[model samples]
Target: MTTVTTPDAIVTAARGWIGTPYLHQASHRGIGADCLGLLRGIWRELYGAEPEPVPPYSRDWSEPSGDERLWAAAARHLLPGGAEAPGQVLLFRMRSGGVAKHLGVQGAVGRKPTFIHAYSGHGVVESPLSAPWRRRIVARFTFPEV
Candidate 1:
């Protein structure tokens, strides 16, 4: 992978994994990856190392504990902001009253905005940032400038 230095580079790297199969906690491109795995993969491509070791986690890892573990971790490694520009990391709450766990990379902005994510049944896809999906967005972050 080429060095990822700009937001455009981040978006390009993420878009390159468009068809990767979805597998829980896996990060290998074209083989399998969950939402977080997608982010991890991008981080590796950009920085050549993971910011931190991610312990094994289940689909409902933090539901019982009611903790925002994923959001907390993103905050630790990503730049916090409300910018809706391309390449931003988006955090979503899949269900009301639950932790925000779902993640996606912003792919486009302006009319017909889209985001790339690894969906369970659909593998990796770029989906329209529709109103229903928009409502679930809890936080937006960008990769630190390297």
Candidate 2:
């Protein structure tokens, strides 16, 4: 894999995808991408290709599958970033009894933290990291070796 020489470069690359729509399984810029696709796009821009080809997945991919597969995969590739940090990847469990599936990028942290994510109808949005959203986070990741 190609190396990402700088952290700002990662942020810049992720920011470039701000307006893309949330189309499941796509990883193209200006066209469409879901939350994971946004990260896939960033990985491609930073490293020239995805570390591993993603398998076909459903919207409820891990929610009912009863496995923390996404979190596990992230653990293998991304450095753990503690609880709060700008530009960190945040994983969310959409329900109380479901597996962690949803993912987002923390854009700000402190009194008024915010995260960027692609919601089904909202597309890509930087949302306030409110208590409710905070409660669902299962893992946090920084780019590897950063």
Candidate 3:
């Protein structure tokens, strides 16, 4: 038996992982996860298997390679959408001209906007979508409904 996954379900599953310790290249619910790990964990909960095998990556996962690896992978797997919906995946560039490496799942939208991410030193936490964060958004995507 498999669970029916919806946008709301994705948000709920991601929220359930709040407080997990941030760990590079790891993804286990309530254990450890990075920004990408958090998303991968939610994906596992929504679907029985990972869409593709993730290669072991360094803390700087392809930034030196000058490729938008995270953004590319999101485009390949998730549905493209505007960043105005709960459960949408958000890709961010840490700095101008940098690769879009950070990721988060949108939480509350419109009023009291927030997003869930496993930030370094912060672990998994839902952060307010402040103007600074909003400005860094490079791409948005939603999990494909099952």
Candidate 4:
């Protein structure tokens, strides 16, 4: 059976992961999860299994190679180019000319937008989509319809 998921449901599921410790390449809820791991966990919760197996990655995430691997993977699996909405996946370029690496789930929109993400040293938390963060956003996407 195809499971229908809502944006609110996605946001809720992401919120449920709050406080998960940051662990490189890990995706277990409440135990450890990196930004991508958080998204991977949410995908597993929404769908039965991941669409593809994730290969081991370093914290730098292909930065030295300047490959847009994360963005490419998202575009391959997610519905790309969606309006800013709760549950939208956000891809961020942490530095100028850097390969987009960071990921987050839109938690709120409008005047005071927020996003849920697993930040190193902070775990999973809802953070304001502040100016600096907003400026770093390179792409927006929504989960595929299952």
Candidate 5:
């Protein structure tokens, strides 16, 4: 499988998005990007297109249905992470029992880990992979095949 696993390239691409406003259901490279849009933007940078057409999803992924659809979809397409390196996708569960809905790109690892993400109120910002955030991580994934 062709993969663009370069950490610098991924980090650089994500860094370019700093200050982009958060707009849900939108994925423009610089204009507006939500958390998923940030990842989708990087995917386009490395692979030219999103791996699959993201179906229209609510911020709540059908809470009444109680489905882990986003996680399941990530499992289907993106490369899963366990022994992960920099540039991998980090999926986070915002609350203890909430769905795994946040997406961040692993910017660095080892002592002082960091990740880049476009938060709802916080635009595109790079935050430390602090204990609180780390505790919320439900899954980690890497770029898809190029």
Candidate 6:
């Protein structure tokens, strides 16, 4: 049976990964996971197997080539252009004129919004969606219906 993916469920699943170590291209819950890996783990919990295989990626994430590879992958797998809400996937551009690479799952909305992500040094954490972070958001998306 296919599970109905809900915002609350997504948030809960992401929250479960809190404190997981940040490992490049790894997706094992509580052990290691990158930002994309966090989303992949949540996708597995909500839907089953991943829709596609993820090739090895570098820390730059195709930035040197000026390609939005991560954004393109997200567009392929997720429903784009969703209203800001808990559980939405947030794509961020870490700097001006750079490829959007960082990702986070929206945790709390409205006043004092937060997002859960696996940062380089901090591991998995739910941080306030402060203005600096908000300014870097390049796109928002929701998981596809199962």
Candidate 5: lDDT of 117? 94
Per-residue error at 130 for model 6, in Å?
Answer: 0.2
RMSD of 1: 1.0
Which model is ahead, 5 or 6, in terms of lDDT?
Answer: 6
Q: What is the C-alpha lDDT profile of model 5 across 64-100, one tens digit per residue?
A: 6867787887888787776757888899888777778
What candidate 4 gets wrong by more than 4 Å, as runs, is: none
Residue-by-residue lDDT tens digits, candidate 3, 1-146: 12766668888998999999998888997789999999888888888799999999888878888987888899999999863888899999989988888999999988689999999998999999999999999988988878
User: Which residue pairs of candidate 2 clash?
Assistant: none
lDDT of 5 at 57: 80
> Runs in model 5 with CA error above 4 Å?
1-3
Which candidate, 3 or 4, would have the higher TM-score against the true structure? 4
Between which residue pairs do clashes occur in model 6?
Answer: none
Candidate 2 structure quality by residue, lDDT tens digits, 1-146: 33663545666677777888889988787888898898888877766767887899888886665878888888887888875777788999888888888888887778998888877887777789999999999888988752
What is residue 82's positional error in candidate 4, in angstroms?
2.4
lDDT of 5 at 100: 81
Report the poorest 10 consecutive residues by lDDT, candidate 2.
1-10
Clashing pairs in 1: none
Candidate 1 residue runs with Cα over 4 Å from true position: none
What are the runs in model 6 whose C-alpha is more than 4 Å off? none
Q: How well does each candidate superpose onto the true structure, as a TM-score?
A: 0.96, 0.89, 0.95, 0.96, 0.90, 0.97
Residue-by-residue lDDT tens digits, candidate 4, 6-55: 89889999999999999889999999999999999999999978889999
lDDT of 1 at 34: 92
Candidate 6: C-alpha lDDT: 0.94
